[model samples]
Target: MSSLVFDRALYRRRLGRALAAGYPDFLLARCAGDLEERLSAVLRRFGLAADLGSALPLAAPALRGKAEAVLRLAENPDAGGGSAADLIGDLEALPFAAASLDLAASLLSLHAVNDLPGALVQIRRSLRPDGLFIGCLLAGQSLTELRQVLLSAEVEATGGASPRVAPFADLRDLGSLLQRAGFALPVVDSESVTVRYGDLFALLRDLRAMGWANALLERSRKPLRRSVLLRAAELYAERFSDPDGRLRATFEIVWLSGWAPHESQQKPLRPGSAKARLADALGVPEIGTGEKPGGEKTGGEGER
Candidate 1:
């Protein structure tokens, strides 16, 4: 029962290529800055912070001010991180000991994880009590324009289509994952950023440089037809172009923040423990479950 969604080894190779290509930093920079701001808002100093699977030095540098020590973990040994990485490790399988870190942050990663919930559980287990975890990844709606055009174009050109992009998690599903992974006070949000490109080819170049190419285990091994690509570009320019003629490519960044559970963290009230009745807040009569409009119980007589 292999539940893997991505080819980890292939993705690592791609990540290595991205580093060699001088990976674009705009999205990483944005996410890293946001991670720092969110961590800063906590006001508590962290003794140790780890940047998990970010594949770069972005989060580590930003975390230095808030933590006494920061660990930069890279996905590939030859990722050219040089002094940037303290260790090379896998995000799916963290190498840290239990309760070792006071904070952990990942930027623009996690979307490629084969078992995201399991990875999150490991992240929680590695954190000290009340330790914070902040991360951002591409949401399901990321690259909507590219996804649509590619699928439509492929179908039109070849009479069928295969996955050309990886499937990303939804915001609500991510929030639920946090809770299921034993994270306390989980918070998830999404911000959509639309980037303009001269055309689909320009966008494809950026995606390749980002190491965000299709890594799904279920992806087709066959090369995309040149005709399909040409059709996709044409459709992209036709459907997604602005008045100025630049094509729009949306990237929805989903931010997830949570803390390791501790006694001090707020807890949900137990069922049937509310001190006030619903009627009191709504200024209306409260009807019992399965009761009639005249206050009659479904299996009993009406109250006098």
Candidate 2:
């Protein structure tokens, strides 16, 4: 509904280079591995599986031998080359027919989607009944120290700051979105990864190599002032560094799972329809109506 925060085109271009380079994507690779491990635990067969927009080259590798066939969808066609993905497509608009896919996953992706809800709905539509979707993305808490230091430095230098860090989806919003997207039994959880860097500049280099540099549409057009950058680095070391002068950076990864609605799936009973009472179920003494649990009548003003 609001204006786009992330510049998808810029993101794609950066991601393309990251994919071509031999530089290792430690965070994305780790997340992909963890996602695949969880998918394997499901022990379900997937006739048609898709890895939705994962930047890591290992996305399809993780799904190998688990799915009958896997396709890696990438926003940039160049990023998909030499990979196991048979087709390259946009993350916001999946190029698949309804009820075609049995499983889908997006590792360290979807955080940059301008229309996440729409993308999720498309993923649900592409899956058949009882289809499973597992995904992991960077949450709001990721890069807390860097964000803070950058903001503080900029504000102090120019008396103002521009949008530098993109907003992230939290667990609650993600779970609600899955339900809104027609997913059943939706679940959301998160894990924190703390990486220590020798300095803030080293961390920035890693982020650039991972294609995680700021791509906010509303970002400042002008380059960041050198003074601000130096001050930010100073503040970072002062506030977030640990002993031995290594700076701590937090990356919060949120994992979500949902299944396409099916008739055979478990459903909750309607309100006031349950046959058992809470007191009886817990083996507690049953209090009569209008009376307290201690056998005292709760009538009159005392009830108020």
Candidate 3:
């Protein structure tokens, strides 16, 4: 996988260009707001925390007074303005000491990591026992319409299509990753944001500005042809436009929270150790599988 590593150098360059261009803030603003909302629900006080991969400068302010102090850690130092990020580090190779941080927060950045499982393991190791980790990432279903349109346009215009969008992790994959990384009480949830655009160009601009364009390792090196680009725009408008002729773009943000293993944290019950049956809790009569409620055999009229 190292041989096919993501072009982080190119990714940084695009992000830098986007920041200099004064690109749109619609997505980043929304992500920051979502992160703030999640941060508000965390009642426990943290002695020290790290905000990793923050696309904006909102993490510190959102976590102010919530944590004793927060040190910003970002992959792109220039992506944020006036941020006190003490370290510029990569997700796959976190620079923090093991078991040093009380909490860690990542804002819409983990999805781009080439070694997601390895990154999660690094995060797990960085936290102290029972330390909390909460983050959000763009899910696999995000921007489905744009991806479909772009592929169709390329295939029709050039007789073949290339990978134009990086693959994102789904909910199941994310939950399993946390567990595999040894996090306890892992929680995964998703929130979908639908934004209307004046046209395809508007959506593209937002993506570029957010520093989230096609950076796939297997992506085509050849520049997109003008004909294929125009076709994609037309298809996007034709297929995904609302009644007002604006394009609909979906951004499914998956939020995940987990805690490092600790003896004090809650643990699941062992198999077959429950004191009460599920049926009893629901106030329903217990019946074995293939048996009726009245203890009769199956294939009866009441079965269906």
Compared with the true structure, what per-residue lDDT tens digits does model 2 show for residues 61-99? 667657898887776766643665566778887899999
Q: Which stretches of candidate 3 lie over 4 Å from their true place?
A: 1-5, 277-284, 299-304
Per-model lDDT: 0.88, 0.86, 0.83
In TM-score terms, candidate 2 sits at: 0.92
Q: Estimate each model's TM-score.
A: 0.89, 0.92, 0.92
Q: For residues 130-238, write the lDDT of model 1, one tens digit per residue.
A: 9999999998699888899999999888788889888889889999999999999999999998889998999999999988888888889999999999999999999
Number of clashes in every candidate structure? 0, 0, 0
Report how far residue 110 has shifted in candidate 1, in Å: 0.4
Q: Write down the worst ten-residue block by lDDT for model 3.
A: 76-85
Q: How far is each candidate from the true structure, as Cα RMSD in Å?
A: 4.0, 2.7, 2.5
Residue pairs with colliding backbones in model 1 are none
TM-score of 3: 0.92
Candidate 3, residues 1-304, lDDT tens digits: the string is: 4555478778877776766666466666777777778878877888888888776666777666578888888777675664456888888899999999999988777887778899999999999998999888888689999899999999998899989977778889999999999999999999888989998888887898777788877889899999988999999988998988989999899988899999998778899999988988999888898886788788645542
- The true-versus-predicted C-alpha distance at residue 236 of model 3, in Å, is 1.0
